[model samples]
Target: MSSMKTYAHVQAKTTRWKLDSKAIDQGIAYGLMIAALFVTYLVH
Candidate 1:
């Protein structure tokens, strides 16, 4: 019974981590896009 509870807690923690990482990935992508645009503007 204790093992089952621990398993549930770990599963929940993993799911939360996945979601947080996904958001971070998206933010990085947007930052890259903005940087590229800024560079292009500077070049032209």
Candidate 2:
């Protein structure tokens, strides 16, 4: 259908999703906390 083709074209033209610096820093901090907990559990 024409509608389906138009929708596909619009979707293809959309910009890629992005992660900003603040989000990346928070994710890194969360991952580090989980890693520390896992290491502590193994050491006990």
Candidate 3:
């Protein structure tokens, strides 16, 4: 019973980390796109 609880806790923590990582990746992608657009505008 205790082992099952521990397993559940670890799973939840890993899931949360995966979600956070995905969010960070998405934010970085958006930031890069904006930066690219700004640079293009400046160049032209």
Candidate 4:
């Protein structure tokens, strides 16, 4: 029973961690896209 509880906790933690990383990755991608657009605007 205790092992099952521990396993559940670990699973929850890993899921949350994965979600956080995905959000960070998406934010970085959006930032890079915006930067590229700004650079292109300035060039033209």
Report backbone clashes per prediction.
0, 0, 0, 0
Global lDDT for candidate 1? 1.00
**Which pairs of residues have clashing backbones in candidate 1?**
none
Q: How close is candidate 2 to the true structure, as a TM-score?
A: 0.56
* TM-scores vs. true structure, each candidate: 0.82, 0.56, 0.91, 0.94
lDDT of 1 by residue, 1-44 (tens): 99999999999999999999999999999999999999999999
Work out how many backbone clashes candidate 1 has: 0
Give the winner by TM-score: 4
Model 1 scores a TM of 0.82
| Cα shift from native, residue 29, model 1 (Å) | 0.6
Predicted candidate 4 versus true structure: per-residue lDDT over 1-44, tens digit per residue: 99999999999999999999999999999999999999999999
Candidate 3 Cα lDDT to native:
1.00
Worst 10 residues of 1 by lDDT: 1-10
> Among all windows of ten consecutive residues in candidate 3, which has the lowest summed lDDT?
1-10
Off by over 4 Å in 4: none
lDDT of 4 at 26: 100
Q: Model 3, residue 28: displacement in angstroms?
A: 0.7
